[model samples]
Target chain A: MHGKRVGQWNGERTYLLCVHCHNPHSPRFKPIKPLPPPQRPSEMKR
Target chain B: MSQDPPCTGACSGETAPDPSRRTVVQFLAAGAAVASTGCSLESFFRKSFRELSPAQVRRYIAELEGRYGRKYGKTVTVGTAGPMEGVKFGYGLDLSRCVGCRRCVYACAEENNQSRKNPQIHWIRVLEMDKARGVDVNHSDIYYDAAEVPRPGHFYMPVQCQQCDDPPCVKTCPVGATWKEKDGIVAIDYDWCIGCRCCMAACPTEPGTSTGPSRTSPPPK
Candidate 1:
């Protein structure tokens, strides 16, 4: 069913199914710290 | 000629008669009652983006255009176009060639017209990971700021919306503001969204990736 594939690990991936990139449970991709924006052109090395 | 004494009927009090406090209270109560009723009616009749008819959409767009045009003193055209048919969107990145310059993040933010200040939003995030560990997100750092990018032994991975076949964000939206389009892209209806931040919390990607409208301040009058 679609619900099973909605990142909920109802069961292990079989011949019929492939695994997802993230764990079904607690699937929060947290970074070490908030990313800073791109550097300004003026800040680049000469 | 002798002037007739003026007679005050209700205003005969020693001190000049003042407006009744009860009258003011009643007026305030009536105003509050009407305001709440209007708000509840609006909430009850509010429709989702997908549910809006073409005519309704046009009216909404026109209203927004008028509001923004007045605010910015320019003609603003608020338009909504449906997704093109037969276009299933996807993205791929080659980690081998990435320089970790974060140029893509800037480009994406510009293209999406994301806010640059107060609650800044970016559509793309480039993560710097140690090559020794081999793609461990827990160990990955996106805040790395070295003198130069593509640092000796680190790899870069630019992350964005994955557009999963069954998006967890869609499943977690309490108000049905986000959903997976037929083309596999996850579309979010900002108008319909209540800014509950459920989708943001549910998204497996970066924490602040799927933000709704900011509720901290109201729009300019």
Candidate 2:
């Protein structure tokens, strides 16, 4: 559904997702991260 | 790190899964089904962003309903609004000029009216990150140790809730305990809180404190 909380605990990564710009829910119904930059194949195949 | 395992359904995979494929085939079938309905699914169980066409979104949502099934179809928690509403709090910290002082953390304790037996829980915290190559990743919570200010060479980053436009904690709250307000601040209904901790996990704020009651912490001077 919604992107899992922005910073989820990836035990392997050993870092927490800081809640700087995210709330668990929103009043305005905004997506946490802006919709991905319009996808470009050049960017995709780095 | 290598991403976690694929979610295996409406959470990922937009193309027809190859039945002939041997390696990721098992996950692909489930993914194809989800993609058919169209929803954002991460390559891993993560809940990553996926662009879904309208038909895909409708289908994905329906499938999610099916997967979670009857568990979510009915009310599992409290819905009655409490007097806790009409209350709001906001936190701001300017990282570009922070000095790694813990005074704000303590000040938050006194200002927010927190319990004194332990550390006063403030929604704000200052962290130190190494400016050296690849060292920002090793940042530490200075509050865990409560040290002196202006630790020589490290860069200071004081973090507080950005009061995000969208909040994941409120969405996943099974009890509807948390809600973002018109002011962009997210307030929790303490009376209705089920303490499921879903909100804490959903918050992206640093040291996203979970103690009962809350307050806005002052910034470092």
Q: Write down the lDDT that model 2 would get.
A: 0.54
Docking class of 1: incorrect
Judging by lDDT against the true structure, name the best candidate.
1
Give every candidate's TM-score on chain A.
Answer: 0.26, 0.17
Instruction: List where candidate 2 sits over 4 angstroms from the true fold.
Output: A1-46, B1-92, B118-120, B133-138, B144-148, B213-221
| DockQ of every candidate structure | 0.02, 0.02
CA shift of B97, model 2, Å: 2.2
Fnat of each prediction?
A: 0.00, 0.00
Per-residue CA lDDT of model 1 for B3-49, tens digit only, reads 22233464476654334554555457656775776765345445311
User: What are the candidates' C-alpha RMSDs?
Assistant: 18.0, 22.5
For model 2, residues A1-46, the per-residue Cα lDDT tens digits are 2322334333343333323445635543321221111222233221
Structural similarity of chain A in candidate 2, as TM-score = 0.17
